[model samples]
Target: MDPEVIGAIIGVLATLGGVILAFYLANRLTLNDSMDSKSGWRKELMNIASKDEITLADIYRIRASVRYYPYPYSETNQLSFRWMSSLIINLCDEYFVETYRDKHVASYKCSNSSNFQPNVTISPENDEIVRIICRYLLKYHWEARQKMQIFRRGRDLMNIDDDEPSEDVARIIQLILEQVDKINSSSPQNIFQISAADQLKDILNTAFKKLTITTRRYLSK
Candidate 1:
């Protein structure tokens, strides 16, 4: 072969090898680094509870923000988990405060000659709030307790019941499945590979119904 032709062939081969090496390095670096794996409910739970007081309007705004940005892009994606955990914390806070805030009591005090005036004394301190706050604090601890319970049960059943995996998992799974279906129409059909996952999703949908039924039954009982 001519010298010029030989040099040109060598140059093309070197360029192809560089491209292949670059592709391999990219794949190696990207291994096991999925957006889902970095999501931790505890981190988000901390963020939610970091605030002392949260209002219903705050919850609504957080929820709306989450609904707006449905994808995870490192900094931007954490909004979903933070929003959900904050919502839970807010809801539990409201429930505790409403149920345990105070109870009205009526009393009468006698003054001289057949005259009595009603007197009321509000509790000096909200012990119930303190107790309920302790309970909320316990919920923060309960997240770890639940995980320990599962760990004790064994790692073999990591996703045994599916049950949304965690708040973060539930959020990302929806995004993943929606994208999957968008890319391939048949993807939806394959979503049922895990029966527990399906059941878990159904449970989430009817959670309110279950709450209502249980409340009614308890009232009857």
Candidate 2:
């Protein structure tokens, strides 16, 4: 081989090696940053769990008329009910996204909403916004059930104890729909005012506990 040709080949190889090294280092740094951001949330969550506290204060409790309130989310629930529901739903949604901080799934979760909006570009596995919402709510239900005999799904009546979150969520959702149909003999009327507005605060408290539990589980993984 000519001396000049050999030198040229060595230069090309050196350049290629540098490019590859640069790429690997950049990717490594990004991954580490992602992990650190995740760890920050997890550590904060652990502290919250250790203290067993929720940051959100109870909703305003003064008795007021809700008879003329605008329709809240296609439902007729009172203003306080909607606000409380949306708050917990949004919190659960946040933790669900946190679960995938290391992956591309983080952007799928949007804050400041009652419902989970599935991202169009996300894959099916990562786009389980609805399932994630239910799982979070179910966790709350399980915790609340310990204190109260209510919130029982039909599965409980059948003595079919199950630990699978997906299956339980599905069955509970189905049963809720079915029960809604059976109980309503006529078209549903708009509830101008919710009598149990005060109880929404209780629900919020239980729901936050579930968020702490589920968030910790995801961080551990």
Candidate 3:
């Protein structure tokens, strides 16, 4: 063989090998970064959900953090998202149930209003908290739909429990939706306006008590 031809063939093989190695390394790095990002997201979600007393603000923050997490591509990531959403929904449902059972049930009268009302005074701050709670409920409903779709498609690999939203959950969502409409109608410009504060507070407090009972009953079933 000619020396020049031999050298040319050696150079071409070396170049091809380098390209293949580079592509492999790049793919490995991408997979690692994706796994890391997903791990961080799971950690944050668990930390929030595991709190002794998770609040609406905490849930809102968790939901916001979820947006920053990478989009769900793998079955693992999809299952994680579905389970996280379920955890959040259950936490909020339990909180409302406990609140109603402990604080508002005694004062509630069937004739006056079918819903329970928390003992807390109606104020602008409380009203704002209620608004946030409504937003959280809506977000939970949306997540529930997403999770159901995942289950329907059998996309998640984990053996997760049933992700169906209970009748009580649906009822509470409807109550909140109604309350939101009332709040919005009363003050189109600003839901948190002082003028509608009293009405808004009453509506929210009633729904909270009703949701609490509804959740408790569902759990007993």
Candidate 2 — worst ten consecutive residues by lDDT sum? 57-66
Model 1 worst lDDT window (10 residues): 120-129
Candidate 1 local lDDT, residue 84: 32
Candidate 3 local lDDT, 1-221, one digit each (tens): 99999999999999999999778656655664577477674455555444444444454454455333432222222123343344334333433333334334445543376554434223233333344444444445345434422123544322223333354344444444465455555533563443343544453344343334534555445
Per-residue lDDT of 145-190 in model 2, one digit per residue for the tens? 3433323576332112223223333343344334333333323423
Instruction: Give me the displacement of residue 13 in model 3, in angstroms.
Output: 58
Q: Estimate each model's TM-score.
A: 0.20, 0.21, 0.24
Q: In candidate 3, residue 52 scores what lDDT?
A: 44
**Superposition error at 185 for model 3 (Å):** 4.0
Cα error of candidate 2 at position 190, Å: 24
The TM-score that candidate 3 achieves is: 0.24
**CA lDDT for candidate 2:** 0.36
Candidate 1, residues 55-132: lDDT per residue as tens digits? 333333333322343222222222233323343343333432332233211222234434553322211122222223
Count of residue pairs whose backbone atoms collide, per candidate? 0, 0, 0
Off by over 4 Å in 3: 1-59, 62-162, 187-221
lDDT of each: 0.36, 0.36, 0.44
RMSD of 2: 21.7
